[model samples]
Target: MSQTESTALADVSALRADLDLVDAEIRALVGRRRELSREIQRIRQASGGTRTDLTREMRVISPYTEAYGRQGTAIAMALLEICRGTGAPPR
Candidate 1:
């Protein structure tokens, strides 16, 4: 193989390693968010409030939409669903 080809392959490998670290960090943050969300749900339920709040969800969705358009909205909604404890769907 040419020297240039070998260097490019090594670069690709390094870049993928970086991507792996980023993926790990993102997973950690998501897990933390889920923990926090569940705790909030518990407190809200204790206070006789619904687990999911549509108005607040919209607020969450808005920044995602502004940052990434349609795809961001989908990402935000998915996160919301994942964080919400198993129960009836929010109205």
Candidate 2:
């Protein structure tokens, strides 16, 4: 390959490595969020509250919505799904 092509390939490889790191961090943060959600569920249950809190959810989504517009809402919803699981009825 030409020198220019080789340099471009190297840059792409480096960017991909950075993306891998970001993905790893996101996964770790999501896992932590799930753990926190479990703890919150425990506390709410002890207080005779429902597992899902719509008000709190809106609060969670608000900042993301402001920062990222419509996509932010989608991101928050995905995070909530990861942390809280789908509201599926048991068989």
Q: In terms of lDDT, which candidate is strongest?
A: 1
Worst 10 residues of 2 by lDDT: 82-91
Clashing pairs in 1: none
Clashes of each: 0, 0
Per-residue CA lDDT of candidate 2, range 2-84, in tens? 99999999999999999999999998888899889978988898999988899999999999999999999999998988778
What lDDT tens digits, residue by residue, belong to model 1 across residues 1-91? 9999999999999999999999999988977998999999999999999998899999989999999999999999988887885645434
Query: TM-score for each prediction?
Result: 0.91, 0.89
Q: Give the least accurate 10-residue stretch of model 1, judged by summed lDDT.
A: 82-91
lDDT of 1: 0.90
Q: CA shift at 40, candidate 1, in angstroms?
A: 0.4
